[model samples]
Target: MTVDQLPPAPAGSPPPARPGAGRTLIRGLGQLLITAGVVVLLFVVYEIWVTDLFGAQKQAAATEEVDEAWAAAAQTQAPQTDTVVVTDPAQLVTDPRERTPTYQTLTGQGFAKISIPAFGADYQFTIVEGTSDDDLYVGPGHYPESQMPGEQGNFAVAGHRVSKGSPFNDLGLLNSCDSVIIETQDDWFVYRVLPMPEEIPTWSSTAPTRPLCADVSVLPSPYEQTVGREITLPSDYAQILPVPGISDATVPADAQRLITLTTCHPQFSAAERMIVHGVLTKSYAKAPGFLPPEMGEA
Candidate 1:
């Protein structure tokens, strides 16, 4: 056939071309995936390495500030020598809101420093009043509903058990008779552990117990209402009044002036609480001349 006549042979349609479009699309997709993967990897590295490094530095700085506050507080004045006498059992009120209260700060011995040799928790923190939603963090604070540290009533203190700044992180490891000391402007109060149940129902009558009551009137709050109520007190009082636990008879009703330290039970969950009870044994007005060699300059 002649060259001019060959063109007329394919008048109706042309043959299908090869399928290169699929291959082109896949190559574009692969490039996009690689770019995305690189960006993700960079983000993880920043969080794992850079973010943590900065966070640790910030924590250290915060601790220093807490210590300084403690030191300043210690220099203020010694605790007043008010002889707290318990009187008028019927007149005593346990309702946290009813009592006239005094607030104090918890500081380290030399400075506002707190340390748990058992848990290796050594840092400077402050103690504030109230455990309302606004004030859980920072450090342990005295609950006004309870008695003061040296008072003849229960002195309860609460603190966070987890998180980096958790002042009570080692609270869980505290066994019976572990030492939990608090150093204030006046003196260092030492508490000895007493055997108690790990869990107590908040509403149970046997839940709250008075620890140190020289007289019925000296009670910080009403005994009938406060005993089993979900309140904090001195660890010493916990020995006399124990709530229902796996074992109840072991806890004595005569328990008085109890000191209670409460934190989360299973590390993170609020499902239960882990409590440590102690008895107030000795009060040292000044830093003891003979501290264990291990007790460093806090």
Candidate 2:
């Protein structure tokens, strides 16, 4: 019989297996997948371990240095005054040069520490100096135009609520009459929290003025066009203060120097902001009497 007609080689010559083709293909694909997985694992490890660990260590060292610098400055300028009075809020200053070594160190190391016992905040944070686009997610922000901690108008600080390192995590838990204390290398300032008016929406409100409802409706006015309207201060009377949308003309007048602590509300979402307003009660230099346990001999 002719070869072509020989019953197709008993119907099962094993199809002449493709000479290592399957093995070579599988080996190549396996190697590619393994390489990709290894690369991904390495990146995740770096992010979870190296970045966080090294970053945190660097920040801590920087903070210590900043604290030392601030202590030195206070010693030279104030000479450990027996008493610190807050008679004039406008006199308080946040001199860049006077920042504690800790402040400078943390700031340079990509974080800043913000502690307020009233709100239960004691965390290291990134610093965002303003409320603009370039200022989000970095840290608790310091309103540059606002007064310092002991200042008269309002020293406002804002931070994330649910971030792992939430610097203002407990701000929402504060009740009226709570004690809010902020500390640095040079001084510790204490404040008394107060209740904000119910009708005053959170600072996250985008309305041009206070919003009004049927029982608490806002009145229409021409002052809505004013510039710097977004700037809210502790001294602003409820009636004239820009509410984003609601209007009230008979709110109580502002009297005391204010310090406002703001953080994201409802835990994980940025949908709203919780605000804790306080009035400065006392302040003292960071002497032995004012130092925390961890501060050592400072």
Number of the predicted model whose TM-score against the real structure is largest: 2
> Relative to the true structure, how large is the alpha-carbon lDDT of every model?
0.47, 0.47
State in Å the error of residue 78, model 1: 9.1
Per-residue CA lDDT of candidate 2, range 1-29, in tens? 12212234456466654437766676677
For 174-214, candidate 1 gives per-residue lDDT tens digits of: 64444455555444555545533332232133323433221
Question: What alpha-carbon RMSD in Å does predicted model 1 have with respect to the real structure?
Answer: 14.9
- What is the TM-score of candidate 2? 0.47
TM-score of 1: 0.47
lDDT of 1 at 27: 68
**Candidate 1 ranges with C-alpha deviation above 4 Å:** 1-114, 121-125, 196-255, 287-298
lDDT of 1 at 294: 22
lDDT of 2 at 150: 52
